[model samples]
Target: MVLTRSASRAAKCIFKWLPNEILHLVATELAPTDLAVLCRASRLLKNIASPLLYYSVELSTSSSLISFARSICQSVDASLPNSARLLEVAKFTDKKPPISPRIVKEINDALCRLIRLEVLILLQRSIDYTYLLEHGQFPQLVVFQYLVPSHALPALTSFLNRHKNITDLGFISPDSLKFSTPLSLPNLQSFMGSFAFLSTLDLTDVSLTHLTLLLYPPDIAVSHAVLVNLHEMKMLSTVEVMGMHANERAILHVIAGHLPHVQELVFHHFTSTSSPISPNESVNIAASLETLGELRSIDFGGVGGNVIEDRHMVAQWSAACKSLTSVILDERQWDFKENDWVVSWNL
Candidate 1:
């Protein structure tokens, strides 16, 4: 599109009058499509917009992913000093052909240049492409979540050891449970995985503050050894358990007995569980609460749903656990108000 002489002059004037910082601020608000247009407008605009364009890349489609990988591999644009701080690559469909071995190599090669990356997430069922990420050298990466295969554990260990900046880590693969190597990351703060996986790691020196234990189907009980290891996490104050089975009471008992210093407790019970938490079970729950003097809040929003309707039981809990400031029973939120419990429904 050719602009008239007057339009071109006005555009030049606008660009000349705007400071680079102001132009950068405007560039940040532009969508990628708009940013691309801005980049083509002028050399100055291109320099201002190109970095923002690649700051965060989330590609879900096969074509887009391949195109992005190719661009990164071919990137000679010095304006983009480093690659994206956040990169999320997800394969949404199973029907599409698997990423070719050559493309996989290209992707891995491209990822190596993303040394400034702070967050990397891979959401795909197959480990074919993800296993290659073990070679990635994202030293600045802080959060990483990927499904790792058992065979790649050795390389993964080396990858993780090299990147000590990672604080929040999650493993979605069941094969991650087989990881029993001695791993250490002093700066690590949050971990999400199964109890078996947690037990396998020697995180005794790592001061983890948040723990999300996935127990869907409750395949393996939270063993005594796991609890013993969990108790050693002195900085651990928040605990979330998502699943249910016959050992619900035992789990609660373990939490109360082991992590007395816990401040917030959340239980998201699976809907697949046949038995709802009974009133008698609630009484047992209250009994467990009585021991948690430092507990500040307990959320059972997804535990028993509407089954826990007794306000009196909550009052009993509030009375027993003086530190309790908030209680979420399913959709209801009972907050400790000015000397009394005020009810608020979470609609």
Candidate 2:
């Protein structure tokens, strides 16, 4: 005779109870309604759900982000060095006043309590970044994505100084950046160079492996010069020029003379010199693209339909970048049609 335990008695068993780990996995996979029900199971369920939710919270608008941040620095439980992760931060932007100075210091103090914070991504939201060096002074930041206000140079420089282990640093979009003091991150790997004013800063000393400049076109000429200035730091991988006139002749010396080491490249505008830049130099077509020998790809940009004179230019690009396997061109012009250029890949 097989006897079965009573329902209440079986429910009381710890092993029989749905494990919080399993619930967590399910919570992530289940519908929001299902997840809410699990959270209501008990305090234990609530605690687990909080981390899964708040640990990587991506908030919405900058104003909303400010409210939570305000509450974080104000919470009676918000003591520095022992405070826990606050949940539900959004990824938005607003000109909310920088966190008050007093709150800034406390938030910094609170972050110090965290023995570890592996990855932190602060998008467009304005922050009390002044306190970052104090708390997010974390030892090992693998990916640090923060868009700093250009005026927050002190805060930015400070963080770079304190957090020496950041592998990927995204300065996002720093407007009117006057200068960059020396950054001492010995282990730094990649950097997103988007600030317009950064061209004046001397970044010659830092070891940068992969660098990108998504800044405006007028500045691209200056930025390209900066890349050429890198001399012989060979670990560089890709170069992208956005919405820029392709022929920035000033770069010929640096690109050809100095940076022969760059392998993959991208282009948007090819400036026509009206006269061949170099007598034998030919119009600066990839067909004539004698420089950047190791280039493998080019990310072409959108062109207005009014311009119909880019056939020879496109053919030159195809012929010049011999190693190019991928060419991403915009669809509006169909200049490729007249040029008899079929890239096999479309927009």
Top lDDT prediction, candidate number:
1
TM-score of each: 0.85, 0.67
Residue 221, candidate 1: Cα error in Å is: 3.2
Model 2 over residues 1-347: C-alpha lDDT tens digits?
Answer: 12232345357655246555665676567654454465577655554554444344356665555444554556454332232333233454444555666654654454444545656666544445556654355665566776666666776676667777677666655353534554556566676655353354345665656765555545644655566556576776665543334443334444445556566555445433222233233354443346667666555454332123334455566576555445454532222444365545444
lDDT, candidate 1, 32-90, per-residue tens: 89988987898777777777888988877777777877887786774363848998877
Instruction: Supply every candidate's count of residue pairs whose N, Cα or C atoms clash at under 3 angstroms.
Output: 0, 18
RMSD of each: 4.3, 7.3
lDDT of 2: 0.52
Highest TM-score: which candidate? 1
Query: lDDT per prediction?
Result: 0.73, 0.52
Candidate 2 versus truth, CA RMSD in Å, comes to 7.3
